[model samples]
Target: MHFDTRLFIFIIINIINVRPNFGQYSDDQSYLSSIEFNRGGSLTNLIFSSPHGGFLGANLTLKKLGKSLNNETLTTILWQLPVAGCYNDSLKQCVYTLKDCLQSNNKILSYHPDARCVIDRSSTLSMYLLTKAIAQSFVSHYHPYTILNKLTRQYVDPAEDLPRGTFLLESAIRAYIDYHRLIAIAKEAIRSPSRGLFIEFVFHRNSQTIQLGYGFDPLYPSTMGKPSESTMHELISRSGPSVIIGNNSLGYFLRLNGFEYVIPMEQSQQQRQIRYRLSTYSTRMHADQRFNAILFSYPIERLRKHSIDQEAKRIAKAIEQFIQTNNIKILSSFASSLLSVNRIMRLCVLFLSQSFTMLYISH
Candidate 1:
């Protein structure tokens, strides 16, 4: 046999063995179905996601979705700045082949070498956080963050409604459905006579404060307060917030952490309503009302310039302390050991560094 033929056969054999009956898939298809949904470790009642950290453009899919290749939101958020968004042509063109080879096919992989900074919570390192969280929780989804730039009606504004087939819009709807489903699954997991906490991790590129969203509305009329055991509102915020707290105790938590945060809701009723809607959905979504949620948002900016790993360790430590301080029981002994701040920091750093490495390789 020719040398090329032998090499080709070897490649084919390996691909078959690894994929197992999966044959002939486009990069986008492979990514959307498998690479995108990276659930590291086990199904714990914890999830860490960075939806916009994805560098692969799904250019073909986005084109079909009516997104332009040059949308500003896409640029600003994903390919915009030199520090965090997409930076060059290679990342603009999705390349996962090298990434797949590097990871050894055992884990989920996302590749975009030109863009390393997509914003945290909008992180490319969500999978790492998810993997780390699984050591403790019962179920989790660590997600990569990617944006479909031209899906919105306005190129510069992300707040505008996205037209159908727009990538981000599709992702948003999928997430909405997924979160509801996750909540349902988590409810069952939490109810099995096992004490568990549903922890969701998010990224916040615009702020320095790590906001722990518990769904308590301090301004909610006294007559209409969230339930003491409420994790429903908390879950909604975990999925994503309507508004970040700007003032009050929650705001104070940011200050305590040596970070700055804006309390938009504290100052304006309009902002409050905006946030309220962003955090909680209509009662029609029956699943959201039944459970409580515990979520935390980290600042992505810190990852770029500071030893934010120390801060991440601090957050993990705080959670451990919170659990012990309140006598919360975690089911797995493995989880108990993994809950240490040092371990969590290591896992978080590993994922972030790997994701960043994939981007730099393109340069």
Candidate 2:
């Protein structure tokens, strides 16, 4: 019996063309239940992620060997429960670790007049609201992809490298994996032949300034900096540092909208004294030729209950103005066209392969 070369080629082509559905999560029930993933519209090229804002505790299970699954052991401080209290009456300063909190009769005591823990709840909520506001600011069909971790930082910090982030707990490890998988899926969805932006929302309580990190060193001059040194080096090289510190930059728009504490402005004094330069694992690892990454560090005050709405609107407006000025949306459209050209090329290749196979069979 003669081999059916045409049928084999067709089968190979179909298999090669098969790709994961970028719009949805894996069909596994456990994966679907692991984290929160908000799917974006096909027309939008924006993605936002909140890794530290989750407060849900993971119900962890140990392996048969009684060992944490990962190679790195858990930090000693992480083993102890976190506390929201001062270590002693004299200091009157609240700490994050239980070892630093006041202990009376073997019980950790809260010492601060207003007990508060280092959690990212406010930042998470603010990001969610800001995403909605941004979508509203755009046309009806455009929406951004969002991923939020539900497990608290105590159990999992998806923003960190795996071993430290999960502490080797089985459930926490699964959740961490799910969080990143969702981000990858979202990125794939919007990268219509490679062009998009990723924003990560982080929180800091020490200052009320809004820090925008582009993976630059905190000590580096924001205005007169070298583009090649940044994580968004490609973008900076193409658009110039002006995109970051020029009159039409995000910092400028934010300042124009009454946000006095925006950092990395053109020749701003705060650029030298105060800077976050949060070249986090997420931003460093995810930024590539396909998409540019930025970290938005918001102070707790901006996301407080009384001000979250107004702050979200202000941020949305600034972001909208920045995008318009930079023509980022136009770049996204160009990327879509590139994707179409790629698809047409792939179809032409398949047709040529089929025609060659048919000719061989006829001969």
Best by lDDT: 2
Mind giving the per-residue lDDT tens digits that candidate 1 earns over 212-302?
5454554455512434323444333433233233322334444555455534335467545533112212121222443333444556566
lDDT to native, each model: 0.35, 0.61
Total clashes for model 2: 0
Instruction: In model 2, state the lDDT of residue 254.
Output: 86
RMSD of each: 18.3, 8.4
Instruction: State candidate 2's TM-score.
Output: 0.66
Kindly report which residue pairs in candidate 2 clash with one another: none
Model 1: per-residue Cα lDDT at residue 318 = 44
lDDT of 2 by residue, 161-200 (tens): 6644554456666787887888888876665454677877
